[model samples]
Target: MIPLSGDIGNAKGIIRENLGTVETRRGTTTLKRGFAHMLKNGVVMDVTTVEQAQIAEDAGAVAVMVLDKLPADVRKAGGVARTASIRIIEEIMDSTTIPVMAKCRIGHVYEAQVLDATGVDMIDESEVLTPADEFHHIWKWDFTTPFVNGARNLGEALRRIEEGAAMIRTKGEPGTGNVAEAVIHIKNVNTELRRIKSVYDAGDEQDLISLARELKVSYGLVEETASLGRLPVVNFAAGGISTPADAAYLMTLGCDGIFVGSGIFKSDDAKERAQAVVLATTFWEDPLKVKEAQKMVDERQSMLGLDTKNLELRMQERGSTA
Candidate 1:
């Protein structure tokens, strides 16, 4: 395959790009010829309105996440056993040229199946906030759709990958004006995984599978982490990334991207907050950028006495199902 690396400098309307890859001036990227570049880099906006989508695109986000309601509601409603209106998803997609993604109830295969036909670039099988469903462990073998599932930590992430998820996100639920719990879990997994190779004693693919079964994570998960040498197969640090510093912190940890749900809206100036997030993600390691961006988001959010603990109470009363 001839590399198209040097072509981006100038092109005649992108006559051809990166060998089989196609890029139109309109900003639509097709990754047929080379790597699937949809999920890499930049920010994915979390929005409930079309206006938000426009703001995200202008802010230079690579994608936008659309939801029917805030994450808190999404969790409580997870058992409805149906899909949200495709129009909401379609409208969000139409409103922006950037990639559009939506959240479905956990293990909601029916909803996931419908998303395949929605012209969406990705689907987030989020557990942080999903409508209830009788089924669990959404089987990825059913379709070739590129999926992103929510993970509280490393083990869940590994399983999802084994099941064929194309992406992993912080299980920390978004919305509620607070960061999700999955944030801490991701780091721990990354740490525990340090011993993966040493424990396996053999790098053969089969060895990894045997380890996963022993760890009770997931066989597919073991395969991906062992293969790519990364805990998340294109994992993104999500939830609780309310400020630029938080975004940068995750990126510094080697996250593929950051998903900002309620963080953007929590600020007094939504547009400015969104822009700061995008910039921080691109320049995460730069202390100068993080310091400056934090001032903006920090001042905007009132941290005193903000209680987001109801999610736990509700969960204790209501447990998980298939």
Candidate 2:
């Protein structure tokens, strides 16, 4: 993998050198990205309780995201959505053998610190919760825990990677059960990447610099991404994926995997829906398998989806400027 930042030391070395203490959990860019690599071609599910976490594990999730509310519920109970309770997070952690992920509000560094101390396998600096800092995101290089952030376009995705995000996911309009926004974001990133690759092939060094400037990221990182023809880190599809078809569509679109939030548990058959999503994600290229997975759930049992246009809060818009 291309190191967006310089080679970082081990997690313990990072903590001792940067934070003035020795912490067992060391956060290194390589280590973090390595963790994300293990999750490729898999699904990461959102869960609020130990039971849900266990259910996700049983359903073959590579990881579980511990959150206080499902994205749809967070939208309905329109208030501050912060990191989940530590007690619940700890319980989920204890109950599952699979990696446990939890969210922190965007730019909330201290909240990240708290989650890091709690020892989550990964931390999502999520827009699903209200962003705590609008102008800047957390400098993820400071933490031991790996972070995943949302992006709506190529520039946002590259900027987050430059800032030390171990993983990137399209910031689709969450809780809406709509996949259109996710499709747009992923296509935008792919299109921009192809454009940059062509420019690189032409050996237009100055134009590369201009492209980096437009993307709001380091020129070296831009060049590296162009050379590789993709983001250096794993990229996952997220937001509004409520069905097996949605999961398979994204996989065919070249996403490393999918993140299903309110889609699974909010359905009438959480267990069946969860398992079907995993099956679809794993066998995404096989139309017959995907069709079978789709048949496993009834559309009527799916969560009441909100049209993306009608959403009062556009979480996907967060960090879009960056």
Candidate 3:
């Protein structure tokens, strides 16, 4: 319950006696930390199907994404808000104990709220794929959930962080093959932060965004946000992540984690690609291990489109697709 620290043991006992054991835990870990452990290490697998999700879980993804469509959905559907069916999401969750997340339409808090009640660990207010009625801003503070939102630039990332999103990510255009955009954003955000810091020393308890725009960097936090402890939440580099090298690059660029969709499954080798991405992110400094792991990933992974098309057909059959 209270993370077991100090003489709070005696205090905990008193509180439990007065309130209830359930009340104490509900206040501490469950309510306060909700799914923090689920993403502590931050390796998320973006999958379009149950089979891909199982592979991701087996290959070491801390979490997985299951949706009816990926990038293609974003391009074709005009907006990707609420693209995945509850049935699809539940199927993935049922198959994996690791946490599961799905993308939601922008400004579609209702869809996100539904997933939260369904026991989803996270949601991406994915502007890249969401078909929101307006800008993809969801009032995260109102939800009993932790969410991750995508940003093309640092300004958006900062806004999401301020909005209480537990995670931040780079926008992957759902179906695009290019990995250049994400790489640039990660590099710039980190590089720009250094510039902002040169002008002024951020006070211990000052605003992080002023420092961020001043320092010109984007972190999960702005500096004064959460004590800068191991990153306020998790920051996973997504979009256009193509190979083991790209994964390694992001980790070096200072990503807390990554998510791969078309990059892994779309490759000529799915299992090998998935395994390689995992190995690359987890053991980035070890070249020898990376080399060995390289062999584990399939150089020719399958693309995500194949998987998405199948989901579309199935949804058409049901006539009740999201």
Per-residue lDDT for 1-322 in model 1, tens only? 3122112223221233354575533211123112224556778877877888899899888888777764545544555423446888888887788888776767777777788778677777765443455445676645445677776656666666555565677665454445435456567567757657554546566666666766666565455455445654466877666777778878877778888876775456778788888888887778897777666665535322124465453321111222
Q: Write the per-residue lDDT of candidate 3 for residues 195-262, one digit (tens) a residue.
A: 44443354433454565655334433454333322234456787767677767777887887788866
Best by TM-score: 2
Model 3 lowest lDDT segment of ten: 313-322
Q: Give the TM-score of candidate 2.
A: 0.94
Superposed Cα deviation of residue 120, candidate 2 (Å): 0.3
- Cα-based lDDT for every prediction: 0.63, 0.90, 0.61
User: TM-scores across all candidates?
Assistant: 0.76, 0.94, 0.75
TM-score of 1: 0.76
What lDDT score goes with residue 273 in model 1?
Answer: 83
Better of 1 and 3 by TM-score: 1
| Least well predicted 10-residue stretch by lDDT in candidate 2 | 4-13
Using TM-score as the yardstick, the better of models 1 and 2 is 2
Best by lDDT: 2
lDDT of 2 by residue, 1-322 (tens): 5444423343332543434565454456667889999999999999999988988999999999999999999998998999999999999888899999999999998999999999999999999988899888988877878889999988898888867789999989998888999999999999999999999999999999999998888888888889889988999999999999999999988999999999999989999999999999999989999999999999999988888887789988876775
